[model samples]
Target: MEPDFPLRKIIHVDMDAFYASVEQLDNPDLRGKPIAVGGSSQRGVVSAASYEARKFGVRSAMSSVIAKRNCPELIFVKANFERYKEISKAIRQIFYDYTDLVEPLSLDEAYLDVTINKKGNPSATLVAQEIRQRIFDELQLTASAGISINKFIAKVASDYNKPNGQKTVNPEEVIQFLEDLEIRKFYGVGKVTAEKMYKLGIFTGRDLKTKSLEFLDQKFGKSGNHYYHVVRGIHTSEVKPHRIPKSVGAERTFSENLSSEIFMLERLEHIAQELERRLKKSKIAGKTITLKIKYSDFSLQTRSKTLPYFISDKDLILETAKNLLYQNSLENSVRLLGISLANLNTERKETINGEKEVSVQLKFDF
Candidate 1:
């Protein structure tokens, strides 16, 4: 670890229960209540749940029925993909105003490399605070921000104070903060892996860091390298700007496992809607629609269908996705379902008769 290396300023911005929050924001009557954004139909799953609902064990991806069971008073609102996309665009515009080095992780989350910002601000913390305030004042939404010397730490810091909060991890505090963190809180450590780590007596960053590199590599394969570095607060990934999106997708994990096709289709429709909104906002279309299924065992599979022409229409995308899901037999109860648009239409902008035009062409890399 190069403890004396020059630091890079990074900020991670995430919206608070994005979909549900947006719903509440649009209807003040729903504010401060246990709310979820998604359908309440038999097959419906949550896209997002408000903090109020979270207190009742409601969470994103949980089945609507289970969410309602967890919180009997839970309010379910149909997701509005178009509206969410509009707000996402506004938020991205604000990020660009500060720095062009913006990398969006999703509609509601992004990383801004403010090492050399356009505003010439020296403190990333101040910039993060200002951005959060602007989002609240202009959009009537709450956002959480984390500032640190690198992307990994910044992302961790942001979640430290969620829902209209900001947290900063200065260079001097990075090591100590990471050392004391629970291993489960690390970015890629999911529930199953966290349990395995606990069984192995590796409960915290410090505990994991104490193991030899070879031992960790033997245990977790390629991801061991990531755990090794992140535990020591060392990460070298760069924030790529305006990188062409390789795939656009949305997914929901259910609280209770689902086995019925009707329920699964309902959840797929919601994800399809989200994918369409993203495709339109990015001004990009796709030739392939992929359906992802996660079984109750946590095993996952993806099935894809490629169309003859680029498409961004909601109905077309959903139809193709439904076909793909049917073609791939569901062998087990599903815990999560996702839809993705891939093999994007890559065409450079051109002017035809003084008007901007788009031409479709295929390019493949092996």
Candidate 2:
């Protein structure tokens, strides 16, 4: 920790059981019962489950079939992405009211740098409370808030109390708060990584702080340095605003693999249309069109072509992707097809000669 390092006031806000809570809010009947938002089909994945559903071993990303087996009384509802998006925008507007320094991790979670807030509220904890209250009153949603000196500590504090709760970790309490934390509770430490740390006798933050930086780096590569600092309540990452679009893409795995070029072309066209819509929304055009294919045996291939002039035309993108696909000539049945537009531009430029000259280049890897 460097002296004179400006003390940052960071707040991490996380919506509680976002999807399921939204479902419950819309329907009075679902308020107290276990609810999950996803298809009930055998191949369906659980996108979100309520706390009630979680008690029965239900979890996000679990197979719906398995969730049903675990809790026979589980109620499954279709996912409403549009509704979630609308709510997410509303919540974001509230964040902007306080500070422009907002970084969204997802629709349900964000980190806000409120070191210099609009309200001139000296206490970060009060700011967190006010924001949480505003979210509930305005959006009818419950959010958990954590206020700390840095992003890492703030994120952990938010989870300390969930479902419309808040926790503040002041500078004096930072070290003790981290020292007692479970190794698994540390950000970026997954199950396998936690197990490895445990094997090294590092089960708590104190255990982690005891290790030398060189030793930890030797064990965990680049991320070891991060872990070394976070255990001591040190983090320097700033909350960056959402970046402008550089690429737009969509990919899907087929239920049954198809070897037919016609079927693949149809799928590619659909993905191209999706990309076109996103590009139009962002007011961006890209010069590179990329085609990605995955075979039934799990082998993958990518083909890309870069045009001299950026374009957002769906027809042009689809045609270029189709040509790239044929050029790659599949040797096996294709299980997945994806198309992407990259190397974006905000506006087009013209030469003095009044000629719309453009260059195109292709790159591929087998």
How do the predictions measure up, each by TM-score? 0.75, 0.75
Tell me the spans in candidate 2 whose CA falls farther than 4 Å from its real position. Answer: 1-4, 243-249, 253-269, 272-276, 283-366
Error of 2 at 309 (Å): 12
Which whole-number lDDT from 0 to 100 does residue 82 have in model 1?
98
Would you list the clashing residue pairs of candidate 2? none
lDDT of each: 0.83, 0.83
Task: Supply the global lDDT for candidate 2.
Answer: 0.83
Write candidate 1's Cα lDDT for 221-273 as tens digits: 87776777777766767676765677888888786799998998888888888
Error of 1 at 242 (Å): 2.2
- Residues 112-204 of candidate 2 have per-residue lDDT tens digits of 998889988878888889999999998788999999888899998898898789998877677788888999998778999999998999999
Clashing pairs in 1: 43-263, 61-253, 62-255, 63-255
TM-score of 2: 0.75
